[model samples]
Target chain A: MTGTGRETTRGAARERGSARWEARDGARRVTEGSPGGIVLEIAGLCVDYGDGPDAVHAVVDVDLAVHRGEVIGVAGESGSGKSTLAYAATRLLRPPGIITGGDAWFYPEAGEASSRLNLLDASAETLREIRWAELAIVFQSAMHALNPVLSVEVQLTDTLAAHRPEMSAAARRERAGELLEMVGINPDRLSSFPHELSGGMRQRVMIAMALALEPQVVIMDEPTTALDVVTQREILEQVIELRDRYGFSVIFITHDLSLLLELADTIAIMYAGRLVEVGPAKRLFRSPRHPYTLGLLSSFPPLHGEVRALSGIPGSPPDLRRVPSGCPFHPRCRFSLPRCGEERPQLVAVSADGERRVACLLHDGRQSPPAELGNPDAGSVPVAPMAAWGPDGPDRSLPPLDDTALSRPEEGVTPHA
Target chain B: MSYLGRRVGFYLVTIWAAITINFLIPRLMPGNPVQLLIARLQGQGTLSTRAIHALSVAFGLETHQSLVAQYWHYWVQLFHGNLGLSVTYYPSTVVNVIATALPWTLALVGISTVIAFVIGTGIGILAAWRRGSWLEAALPISTFFTAIPYFWLGLVAVAVFGVVLGWFPLSGGLGQGMAVAFNGTFISSALYHAALPAVTIVVTSMAGWMIGMRNMMVTTLGEDYVLVAQAKGLSERRVMMTYAARNAILPSIASFALSLSFVVSGAILVEIVFSYPGIGYVLFQAVQNEDYPLMEAIFLIITLAVLVANFVADLAYVFLDPRTRQEA
Candidate 1:
């Protein structure tokens, strides 16, 4: 209500006008006994850097629901605001990234009896209790995530000391050891400093510290991005195993759709500041609904099959500040019709079960190219051949496949060359 | 423990090298103070060749002795705490004169630096964190304090606090005829005399610390670990102090150690301007009269202070930054 009307409450808008197409994301009522035990619900969330029209629209009105014990992988190119979403949802986004509107409801307990707590409006004291205890985060960089001066023991016990004050000093320390052991690290290394460990070891240590408080939900923003392929796989296995044991939902954010394919149950592809496609990982991989998703998928040839030269998307991801007028991806969309340029597309169910949703005019059977526009088949123009759409996942540095087939899913990869 | 042992060994070698160099510098200078001492004592009158030889012997600088023998004797005398006679002060030994002035300089410079560092670093953290806020607008204006030299700032301080305000005495280490004792009045008098120079030093160096710390803190704020700390739900105060300030203060500590060593040499121009009789003022007198013993003794003390400061800073780094402990 305070801001100039640059933001819209889509969650409220949906309630007033129950448009048929708006059912794409399913019913987002956030009630206690919803389908899956949705741990976190983000609705009508709008985050802009700076103020007014010129401000960088980092995260436009968006709605996302995360279910308990499910791995939800969020994929996007670097500036697509995936990390911003993570930070803002946790109320950690610093200056410039203003959360203009909407709400993020965190269900504190797992069962149907748990009440919803609006994450965006929580007070300092409540946020402190919710942060590490209920929602832990394994950060992007091992080098910068752990305090370089403090020992691993101190960093792990700091959360315990802050929140679990009833535990004795010896009990707290023993718990720190148990946490480290659960992450497959030697408990004796607790006294070692961050710099004393290798990159892989440091990342493991970071994971250990994150699990220290047994948080209900863990947001891993490229946690394994700084390690090698072997180490990355190992760390992923560790995280998955821990999630299975604790039954905590994970929001894993990465740019490599291929990596997420192996790890996540569901994958959500983001373009500009909005999600173009969101679906179950296997189904989306088999049949992508959005042209952007197709382009990203084509960038990685399927292993154990005839290898087609990867065709890269013709243009770059849009800048959030100006975000193209209609469908954010219309400018670079291969199957874009004239209607794509004239009207914005909402996320609508494309599949029979309402499980998979896409925001492209081509799927809705409404695309009608205007005759005035040159080259009616401009949408059919071929993308770049030998498309080296190298994902911006911090860990990805793969060489071009010569003859070997590499199975990789990419969420939002722009051509590297 | 091995790392600590290595550092101790390193400091010992460095200290030895510094002592040897300090011994050579004054000896290498053009004039021999023995001749000047003889001239002053004998009133420029011609003397017999034997009398000249006797005078040299009496002053413990016999020209007939071998260079190596004299060097050996110098080391032996040094261990016994004999710094030789001061040509400028004539009767007073170099050790006694330095001892008198050393405490005053240590008290003034040490206290000023500690106060300045604390104030400056605190302000630096505040300024960088708030950045564009009105609360810290005055920090930029204070940077001019660092740009002004100590001597100039000292004179202005004297003009203001000593002359204009008439709150403190104008000059000389303490009141000209004040008693030198451990009594409360004597201590207060010394501190009062030291006030102006202390203020000048604090103002000049405090600004430097703030600017340096502010830049480092700004860079530190962007580091991934800081973001991690925030996401971990640490209180803002805890995050700023444990993560940001703890790291930002590393480089500041090194510079602080360097500044601490300079305290012994005392702020030469400031001391002269204030007419305060610290080691720096004594140094000024030594150089003016070419007093080799006094000059060499003071130089040795300064060199040792610098070496020890560097060694201490190395130890501090090991304690404050875990990255440096990797080599161990």
Candidate 2:
């Protein structure tokens, strides 16, 4: 209801060709169901590390949005640049990481009359005013993220004291206590230092601090990667519960595809500094159109199924310093063709009425995709479609996915490390 | 045991060990202070054996007694506020000589040190926080002064400010024959004379603190908490001071404690250059005259001062850092 106009502007920005127009039309066809509107809209965002010709393109031509009351999970390999996208959008990226191009429009009230601010272009004073009051971030590893010297109470109340100067000290303290309680931490431990608390409790304190100002959007940069499985589950559950209570949007960045499958309403798959595919979580899980997304989904073990062998993608994430040409993932793509090697594919809609969009040549209809491409039941089916492979199609025997890709899945995500 | 309790006990044992070593040093040496005094007295006039024995007992040398008995007598005399007589100062007692000089050294070095620490650390914080500012250029220039010896710097200061400029007194703790009184005239004269040495010490020493603090601040700026503090929408000054500098200053506090302990030793070369009546100047005269009693007293005080200062630092550390407050 509120983001209808945003659709048209976003469509107008990408005036590349007829294919892009069709993609724009396809985007317009998807039904808008978000309750409020788009809380944030990022289009054609680009981030580069360093300057001049030697700069590494960390985030390239990325477009993502966080609708009000929605969870958008960004899943990727360790160097796939998912975290870079979030930091660039939030204007939290440090030196050497510069936003080369982009527009990140934030709608604080998420309605027609709500004022929109481009975070990348905002002044220092304006950015500071909007940071914790309208958007907040919970960093990875609360142990290092929290000030070891300050008490939990001081840290939680710091945001309030900074943004809301009119509030009395007593009121701030009471609100800090309420925040700790909301995160299931006892308010009596507010005076304790970070070292005095357990890792789980420290992470809970971080969550409490992030939500202290009740910001409209929260960016969790792998908040639970340092935690054990039990604590991670508990924290994630609490996050979801809090989201429901506050009705705020979350941009959850993690490498764990399995966790995102359960938590995120929509999933954006990134590979080699670009978005490969984006779709509703259930649709992406059941029928991933992009080969990279299919590989990631199959890489992790299913939650409620019999034990089975799993195979990851054949190669590691490409080095940003020397990213592969054409489709960056073509080197590891199982359904790659000659055209995929020469022609760069843009993220366009898979079908006219569907919400799914993919950036692989197979989905572009120049060649026939594998018959089992979208079938959830097709476990590790060989995908050597000759028509798509062109005249120089390989021999019948194709290299199977090997153990080299298995190690990539186990590499943990450490935000800003 | 509590942390303070353990620290106190440790310091007490250290003091006892230091006092025993001070008592043994003169006895262990090839010649004795009493014999040296007797030799000087005999040169002036003939001395009888009984008179020599009387002088030795008066000085608490206890030549005829066993070493154990003399050690016991030494401890008894220490508790009675008696430290024998200073051979260099003749009739003056060692305690009186030290008391006369302690305040001058304390007032000059102690105050100058504190001023240097505050100024250096302040500049360091500003330099690191506003890197590329003109204040950052001050770092290498100031640090260059640390390479110059303090006594040499004192001489150059005297030649410039004292001789060429004629703005301040050149030497001594006070003007010639000025009585040690608490009157305004006497106090102002003393401060005027102390200005050169104090400036020299501060110029040379402040650089060390500035460099240390600046390096530490750079490291702490990269810490995750500083970034998080910035993200919390804190004002630039608040984030830089409360979060960044607050943690960076911890190591400086520990170093400050060490600096305090050495304050009693009095900047020996600078005192010599100024010809100031401080413990360092007195210690130099005692060593040259071989005034064993005076030297022993000063050494014992220096060791005990170090122990006490470290104990005070421990208390401050426990207060500042919660990690150290836990019971061991």
Candidate 3:
């Protein structure tokens, strides 16, 4: 992906300053690879379910970044904590799901660190201001996520009223109708309560409400998990279409690897609450670096290819309370080594250009990546381009990570005033 | 059929059944109201057979008519609102006796119930929203009050606040010989006498509402919509009031409507303890004196009150919750 490189970073950030979705469609190509492209950055994020020794460390020392106008899909198993990471980063985690440590910096100016808001350290008022107006989230079950007593128009207009105080009631109603239309629903159904709508329509209403304020980042947590295939695909298309048209970043989280492989620009594979691999979607699908990612890829039935016996990874997800020491995945790893059980491997660069990284001992350079994982350079399944926006090409603007950015707290991320 | 129409039909059938049962129970029992009246009057003079017959007809205890014919007459009288005469208050009709007591009961129990529900439900919402607040800490104390029999509490209140402290009147709906008019003196004296009983009912019953509402609120707080509302960055008050409590209060409303219906019956024990001259106190006197006509009238009124209240509750559910508005 050709990002808006360094020279135009300041210019691009200025041009996109608080512009509504209607005003800017031409300047939507400012996706991240360079420092100017990153919209959200998390460093050393750790989340726990409870306090003291009995606590289940749901998300541990994880680092991720979502570039402007990028779709970053997070794929993990049931207990992988992808949803927890999203909730913690957004400061939406309920009690007993505490952010023990983390630095989640939301950069409205792309990569300008000075303007970034520290999500975890912000006061409740600041967090409320940042939420919905800047960052919106689409929850898993729309039926339960919507107020049953309220009509669709009321819910949509409520969000608008809370943040868009300058908007008159008439303007808010008109915008809500427009949002429903944008999400492929008839505007006449605006007065219908949630129970009055079908499941797919309710989900579409949820999407419309989330996008009502034209937020910069929309975090979708398994939004289509309960939907049928056709409805899921339709919602997914609308989501991508909305993201493209608005130039906002999306954090799409799900357990379906095949879905993420088809949707995301960059896919992050998590296991046992830790990221096991991070790479371009096509490259990761064709040439998985981590054994867990390989296991996940093999488990999904290939849409086009010679039929093969689908071998699911041996053992269920680890009990978070009793997660095995060292590499948490070693107990179920197909390519486990004695050393794998003794020491945990950190996610590090696997490609020469630092475009892909994996947390596996085989990819640590002491030994070659196992033949079972397939050669990265060799031709594998010829998958289609990531999404309608096309593949994220060589992302060379990403700087090589050192120990500081990986495990250390970010500098200059003080709490918002 | 439409929801309102269906509910009204159902309640009509229920009322018919209740009135039929009320008619049947009195006839099924031996020794009619006229016989009991005659037995008491025998002390004044030996009544002639013709005088006995006239008394029986006046009390609607005509034995010459068949039961079916008597039932028909009962319905006819009920339609005209003729509830017969009270044996206990010999000169007054059943309707007159109830009319005198209804206002007192309605004012005392209805006001006390409404006060309890409002204060209790408000405390419940606050306690659940701020789970560990001082109000929540005080919940157990309220529960203790609820566990204590309200009549016992009323008696204790009478002993302490009425007898010892002399802060309020000890009993009755109004001061003795206070001319029960709409004048300021009568109104103020009536309120003064009602103070102790109202407090007893409010303090004891408010806890049940609070506990019920608190439990519902806790469950509702975990609903996905509540979390979504919070995530929408709305103020805490908006989330609590509109999303959480709005949904949580539904079940409480149903029960509240039921209690509102029972307000017509009054708190029997509390009224007896205070000798509060409400329907409950009158009903107690009727039963003690075996005033069958008065008892039957009061029972029918209480049953009809329940049916009407539930119908009103159904109408409210349609407004408050869209889910219930759909066709079954």
Candidate 4:
């Protein structure tokens, strides 16, 4: 709920930003009213895949508050459990992958006081009510998500019948036509089978279907990953514009940081089943605090500047079965300290802006001393600023990267210049 | 059109080669069919050279003629449907033998194969759609029947429904009292007597189709188009039948048509086992008697039937799948 208030303030700021820029040509006004701002509060979320030795702690002790009318991006490489967190939030994870712990509360604003529903603990009937009516999902592969034999009209109308049975057939058809137009599709193609449509158009149809019920939240798992660059941009732009127009929160999950930079309002960085940083997109993109977040951003090709050689993060994600002793990312961190191998750091507020939180030893406490260049043999390296350390420091046992370590050959590397 | 013309030319040459091979294999066998027929007619008595030479000429034997000359005569006779007279079955022409037997095999096997394919595919779609229900429960049962040897299943059907229940005739094409005519009463009686064996064939073959189709349907269910249909909010039933089943069933139809083409050959074993007087039973008699003329005629018909069946299957493929037509 605290995030909801923050989002409203952010919305007001966005409106002011829009008004100030409106005088310029082609500056369309982005209305602000806490319009699509719904609140999703998840607490003590835990997900485990089966029991005994085969079991996996896929998502552990996660908490997230997604505010409405904003695109919240969950970013991580494969095995970071980013997708698991998203699926868990919607209670969509199937068997063997059980939600061992958590409460996912949805606050849907329907004119009156918001209706609160806990997704994790709800009965099947209640879960069904939430699935398409309050929440919708756009899967990774849009082509795989459509039916090739059925016409688009039949596919669209099926969902309406399931969720809005009271609507007349004519009314449903009219609504479907309106939705197609809203999604920038030609309504005349409603009779066309999925195979007749292009990949991007199929994806657009998927998006239109998700919004058909006017759900409060739409979870898109790499929705445009399969699309071409131009189509991806158009689809994302249309989605963002639609979100603004209709007021629905979006949970965008992708490994594409550059794309997220342009679309998301907030970014939550996840690593090895835990959230390391959650902050405003601009803040996170400009100066990422977590070592993992820094590595992820650096890995991507820069979008708006002179070309630079891309740097991929060293090492694959740790095996979930045998996670590192202290910090899961300590083995790959460039600036790891001894303490990073001794004790796990909890997610706590960063001092630069208490609103932003990061879970790393480098940003733990208020007055922690700057780590000294403790290794006698190594030449002097500039210690990061005390303010840079913020409220956490790396666990002490992890050695900082030395010249020898940097010189070692690895896959996906170009030897840093 | 050119490609089709080339294919037809190729098929004609292939058939000719097959028939030539068929003629050579029997001719190379020890003991000539004509000598055996002559011995059986003459009671194994020592014959004079004059009588022996006379018999050979009557039977169209020609040692003095060149191999090419004999082959040319054979080809000319084949072209006119004069497959020569059967030496073992004296007085009967090869064409007459095949004509009497071909219809019985086609009717029994052809009709049964078609019925099995339709019923099996329907059940398969149902099984796939109603997974985890009783419909799916029938899959293992059908698969069990499918695995049972065809001859074994036929024997079992005959034993239980033929002898024990006395519901149908044990063998042959029709009831013993019924005359072998094309009249409705004869046709109905033949069908009635054929039911138990036909049912056995259908049950045994249907499993293959049902299992194959069900597996395909399951795979198609995972296709994106099916999910898109579901997402579009098409009713689950509509999505299952129209989207999932339609695409999945295409390959089954192709395989079915191909199988139907070969069904004539497959029925030989079943017909021989039951003494059903179909082409297979007649073919067995000819083979036992070393009746080369009758055997060649049957082989020619079967090869042509299979080739025609495959051609029809290809044409059906073009109709069922739009992608094929577009590619063509």
Candidate 5:
């Protein structure tokens, strides 16, 4: 991959600014790997479900950056807080799902300085102004998301009327028509009610409405989860195609790792509300450093390889209220080290270029004896090319630690946010 | 069938069923309309058997015919715009008696119901939008008012504002000394006497509408689409009114239509309580006097009123709810 690094990054940089599905003005161009490439940066983000002791710590301390025009997928099982992370970042979390800590900065591209608003710190008025105009969201369950009583045209025009109140009705209607067409829907269906359309059509309408304003960032939470495989693929293709045309970034969240692996530019695996690993899609799939990530990989059946008996990760997801101390995944970790139960791991670089990071004690050089072993590259995953790695590439048969040694929190990451 | 065709057919069948039931109720009574009329005539002079037979034929009482044949004749009479003569008011036709009282009921009940639906629904939207305020605070008290009988409210109004306060007349539709003409004095006096009963019906029915609307609004606020509307960056007022309340109002519109017909019967009780000379009071008199034809006419009119009102409501839904307009 290093041989074509320059070409790939340039391609990705162009991908960020091409989401111009609708005719829009004043859209600034962004180059990849530049300061302006980061569309949204969330730091020290912590979200709690309730107050005090009984509160469910949904999204614990985490930091993530979504580059302009990149499809960043968040994968996790139910209650893993992948959805919560998206909601918190967008400041869409309702009462009881409070953003206890976080500063999500919206970095407007060059020449669009006024839109650089902090999603969490903005006033209600500012948030309203910035919501659909600059940052829109495509919610899950389109059947429920689209207003049943409203016609598709009305739902589409509602956003335009709010953000562009000065536009003439004819122009608004024309724009809505174009949007439906952009999402592979017939413009004539604008007058149709939600119940009149199939589930896939409803989902497309939602996407059309979200793209109505040409927002810079769209956070889609399982937008295609309710759809069948063919419909899901069609919608996914439309999303990516629209993103490329309009240059808007996407925060695509779903538990379907295989889908993310195929669709996302970068995939982040969250476990028990904590991010366990983050890397480029293919890189992470071929080489998942975290035990939880490995378990998640094993759970999904490989489509293009020899069929293997699916081994779903043992045990249910931990209760958020009674989340275990230290590493949240220690109870479920198959290759658990005694130190994994006593200390939490912060995201640390594993690969030389620091393109990949993992939060597992095995990767912590400060606590691992493998670093001092005979082999110079002990405990580090071999940087094998994609073609060389099989679907189940990780060495999962390794023995559990018998050292029973405990260590302090490495990288100064506390047990809880 | 097409959607409109289906709906029209359904309504036609429903009307037939209602009219059949109305016809059956009068025929199934123990004594015939002719017998009641003969008893009234007995005081004047003992009638001979031949004279009684003529009276029975005059009242359209075909006693010797089978029930099915009588039912057929009743329909035939209805088609010719002939409702049998009143047993109580012997010379007057049922149509004439109802027509006389119908205007008074329409004036009193129609105006009062419109006022209640408007005020109640408006207050309900406001209360649900601003839930912790004084209007919402009064929900329980308002519910309590609606829970009481319609006449009880009328009686209470008469006691507090009529007999005790001396602000209005205690009973009757208008002043006894006022001449019955199309003059300003007669109209104003009639309105003055009706004020208490109208207030009673308005106060009670309005509370029910307001409570029902408030509950629906709360449920609508929880719908996912409402959240989506908010996410659209629309103003709070737009979200509340166009999105939340528009959908919330569907059930209310239907129920409001049904309630419009109910105002007539509700007026009956209020009219009796205050002796307001509307169709309600006239119907009460007919019932007390066993005026079979008059009683039958009033019930038929009420049923027609209910069916027509509901039919109109169903039509209104086709306009408001896009889901129902599908051809299927």
Candidate 6:
């Protein structure tokens, strides 16, 4: 038995080593015969926008794991490098915005075995094949993204023709109609031009297009930013409902923490291109460990909490061109210690849970209590009053109560809001 | 409805202003054309003061005449299709001289302008689509030709192709002994002689359209709708022609209309250099002999043509773009 245990340990180490090596070259590793839950694993990802002294580190030492049927929310203010992480993962980062290091592995679920594919090092042809097949994206500006001259039917059918050339014209049309219905849009409106649709309808059409291919992963970048509150709620509700029925993972990037808490299974908080803290949605919202995460939480009101003005984090995100030394977030961190300015903190597990990890000096040791996280005066950090917050506030009211809460699975409660 | 009515009313008032200015400008020039005509008719001898005054009154050239009376008489003469006699052309009426020359100028310059616009816009669209290719290689040559004066090109063409090679006629609307009649033979012969001058105009004017269309196409390619079209997986050719080319070509349409308005005036120097019996050649004779009525009639016709062209261009905006119709 001891010999068998040793052999298994050695085999596991070798597999891990191979995974690391594959990741270093920007490729995905497909592991076979593993319990099929995890769909994407991103490890040690670093992206730079330039070189030498002028280089901007857009994503630094970031790591995230998205499981099957789980919606992962990535929250950060603009320039905090949240969107860069998404772009880098998809290999869509253009020149001057380079992915210096990292591995984005996609594991497609198949019968009893899982197939892992490396995204970063894949051939252009392979990447093209995977695009809109296994993964898709919905950009923020729906009006600008949709061609004004094209009808909604053409826009949706176009993707099917490109990606699935074998499908007949009638089949493509039928699929498009089904997608529109799935996204809660009337089938009749498919023949209308983009200008004829409302902002919410346009965004829903974008969602339908992204979902048309039945992709395993969908990344949405501030999908509701251009919409009014009522429409925003309606669209988001439809998105959650579709995600539940489709059984696909999602990478939802937004600046609003409240919305993420309600929609995500796990949440990752980014500060200055670094993942400061990541945990289950409940734990991260209930008690965040990183100073930036704390600042982000206190800076906004909870949806279930009292109605009050929103507060905002002090200081702007550091200019990536000339980032501060050591921890990039140290300058803006209220709980920054002398060590924080001198040494960058590596992401470490907060407990033996393996589910929660944070990159902050305060969480350096595994045994540190949750209450002892960050500086003692971190809670009292000076933030602008909620009324003084800019247009991009995190404390907006909750989406309407009719939409089912797809992220919450522990409680048998049907979604009331 | 009210807004459209107001716009139409404004355009009518503008047309009226243009006509009034056209009528007033030639009369404002310092010259007693009636006295000059009387002196010439009297065998170049000095006319008596009473005879000169009587001739001035009869011609409605005296300052004592009411403005309304002079304008009414001018309108009557204009309406009757009479432009008086051209002093330079002996006893020929200005209208007759113009009538004899108009067709030659229209056939040559009008056809050249249309051909230039079509070829230039097509080449420009290709250049924009195939950027960094040999299609753009011809741009510098076109620019060089455009910069050279039309008259200089006419002289060169005549010298090389007519004088040296004897491939085309040197001067006149037809062969030297050809009869001047309105027949198929005469028209075809005139067209044969007009070829070299027409080529010069086409080559010179083509450059402006090419450069303008290319620049506009580049700008339109950068618009979001073009990018959206590309993202939709449309073929590169479809995207280029439908999304980029259509929008870029709009401004060229207005410019082409403006160019057409100038064709009737004709290129004076080119006509003189080739000795083509076009409107420009006739206008030159009028100017040299101080024939004010001929000059005024040509100027008035050219101005009215330009106004009508501009009105048509404005209407075209509604057809080419649906957004304009909505706003209007």
Q: What Cα-based lDDT does every candidate model obtain?
A: 0.77, 0.82, 0.85, 0.74, 0.79, 0.75
Model 4: per-residue lDDT, tens digit, A228-275?
A: 999999999999888876667789999988878888888888888888
- Candidates by DockQ, descending order: 3, 2, 1, 5, 4, 6
CAPRI-style grade of the A/B interface in model 6: incorrect
Native-to-model Cα distance after best TM-score fit, residue A302 in candidate 2, in Å: 0.4
True-vs-predicted CA distance for residue B116, candidate 1, Å: 1.3
Q: Per-residue lDDT tens digits of candidate 6, residues A96-200?
A: 688776677787652212357768778766776777667788877887777665578988887788778999999999888888887788899878778788888
Q: B1-328, model 5: which lDDT tens digit per residue?
A: 3776777898889889988998888777688777877788999999999988997877778579888998898899999878888877778888887777777788888899999888888888889888789989778887888999988878888898998999999998779877668999999998898788888888888888898888899888878788788778889999999888898899998888887876555478888899877788888989888987888878887887888788889889898988777766
Here the TM-score of candidate 4's chain B is 0.89
Badly placed stretches (over 4 Å) of model 2 are: A1-33, A111-114, A306-308, A375-417
Encode model 3's per-residue lDDT on A346-398: one tens digit a residue: 77666655567777776554555579764553223332221222133222233
Tens-digit lDDT string for candidate 3 (B1-328): 4888888888889999999999899878888888888898999999999988988889988777898899999999998999999999996999999999999999999999999999999999999999888989879999999999999999899999988998988888877777778899998998888889999999999999999999999999999999899899999999999999999999998899999999999899999999988999999999998999999999999999999899889989999999998999
Top model number, lDDT: 3
Error of 4 at A338 (Å): 5.1
Deviation in Å, model 3, residue B19 alpha carbon: 0.6
Error of 5 at A52 (Å): 4.2
The all-Cα superposition gives candidate 4 an RMSD in Å to the true structure of 10.6
Candidate 4: segments with Cα more than 4 A from true spot: A1-35, A39-45, A65-67, A88-96, A103-134, A148-202, A208-216, A301-312, A334-355, A366-417, B1-107, B111-148, B156-168, B180-192, B214-235, B238-247
lDDT of 5 by residue, A199-258 (tens): 999999999888888887888989998999999999999987777666678888999998
DockQ of 1: 0.61
Model number 6 iRMSD: 3.7
lDDT of 1 by residue, A178-284 (tens): 87788788899989888888888888888877777766678999988888989999999998777666666789999888888878877888888777787778777
* Model 3 docking grade: medium
Query: For model 3, what is the alpha-carbon lDDT of residue A363?
Result: 58
RMSD of each predicted structure? 11.5, 9.3, 5.8, 10.6, 8.2, 12.4
- Listed per model in order, the count of residue pairs whose N, CA or C atoms clash below 3 Å is 7, 0, 1, 35, 11, 7
TM-score of chain A of each: 0.78, 0.82, 0.87, 0.79, 0.81, 0.78
DockQ of each: 0.61, 0.63, 0.69, 0.22, 0.52, 0.15
Considering TM-score, where higher is better, how would the candidates rank from best to worst?
3, 2, 5, 1, 4, 6
